[model samples]
Target: MILFDQIIFGPIHSRRLGLSLGVNLLPIDAKICSFNCIYCECGFNTTMHDSPIPTRDQVRETLDAKLHEMVAEGQIPDVITFAGNGEPTLHAEFEGIIDDTIALRNKYCPTAKVSVLSNSTRIHKPHIFAALNKVDNNILKFDSAIDRTMKLMDQPVGKHINVAWFIEHLKKFDGRLIIQTMFLRGEVQGEKLDNTTDEEVEAWIQALEQIRPQQVMMYSLDREAPTQNLQKVSVDELNIIAEKVRAKGFDVSVAG
Candidate 1:
């Protein structure tokens, strides 16, 4: 499993966000998440640590030190991203951390954009919603328009989370949200699942029309997914889906 031990780790090149610096708010040794997704690169949410999550002050201090060093070395990142071992919004001090990150970004790397990669499960929280709105890129995951496919792919912690309710809640973001969808096919425990199918794509496009996001980022699996049965959708297939999404009169991009 790939895990980030430092609070501030990568300054790696990303297909979506260039030269991004990553901030990991979750515990260094374990994965603490609200969803147990099958495709998570960090592996399953198996280790639940009781130890206190990184405090607001700790995050501020660590991030400040990193950013200062980068600035001194004349190596400013293109973006400062919140993506680590698990759900960033799950942290008790998430809002405060966002505030700190923005401050650090402004002081050290004014050109860098602040971004958060969230599962959208916690959008119901007022504070989380507010923090997400403050970021330059509020990327939220939307794997499928069908509840059954979502359950099979994401395996959200909350069993009650269905697509209908999810769409209604996601609409709250409106223009600020960037919807990210993963296109893939696989069978888990004898259940066949594929979100790239015509029926699935049509339903998803309908949902996107209602959500009206700033943009849609569709991509296939790039690394080894935790679920071994999954297959990556080709770039050609992703572009085909992107074209369909664009036909609905929304901005769309494919990264495969």
Candidate 2:
């Protein structure tokens, strides 16, 4: 079953961060986010709505208990990850949750790092950025570099958020900005889908130069996606893309 079928999973394994213990900040049915990407493994949000946000105390208690249990059982996760059924930042009490989780992680697993898997939509928020900076890994999503293409692929809530603005704002962040991109080709709403084109990749590469992220996390779909037409880029293709990005002087990791 998909990991989110439960509130938490892993310390299982990760290509980038080893032995990650997941922390699901979103409630069971409150999997809300700004994007409706076709490749999301949780499938598209069924409600198309945001929620009565989960409490910070609730997340802290659950996470603290889990950490304690793992410690007691001699299970030491490498990272305490803020990733779950939906974007962790959407939880209104996100900053508090991050603070609480970090404290608990230090108390139980001092060697472990705290990380987040975010969409970068909330990067503009001062509070969110402050919390993100505290994490060991800030895995932010930037699926496409072209505005029109991004709108179709990510389907974000605010129309004003575009590639240029994203790059400009990302400059404010002090910590390592781990860019996570999904390379795929698939049909959405009866149209052909392809981000594998030379033009698209070139745009992404150029944008990457401006952002100058610490590293790039490139991967393709491996789980059931919202649309059937979406196709994963092969390992050879992923490696080729990584090589090109590396040529420009940035480290890249192939997750798939």
Number of the top lDDT candidate: 1
Model 2, 73-173: lDDT tens per residue? 99999988888777888878888888888898889999998989998998999899989988888889988898878877888887778988788877676
lDDT of each: 0.90, 0.82
**Stretches of candidate 1 exceeding 4 Å from the true structure:** 50-52
Q: What residue runs in model 2 are displaced by over 4 Å at the alpha carbon? A: 1-7, 48-53
Please give me the total number of clashing residue pairs in predicted model 2.
0
lDDT digits (tens) for residues 1-256 of candidate 1: 7888888898999999899999999888788788888888899995666545788998899889989898999998999999998999999889989998998888989999999999999999999999999999999999999988999999899876889978998999877999999989999778999999999999999999889999999998888888888999999999988988888888988898
lDDT at 238, model 2: 89
Worst 10 residues of 1 by lDDT: 46-55
Q: Model 2 clash pairs?
A: none
| RMSD to truth, every model | 1.1, 2.1
Give all TM-scores, in the order shown. Answer: 0.97, 0.93
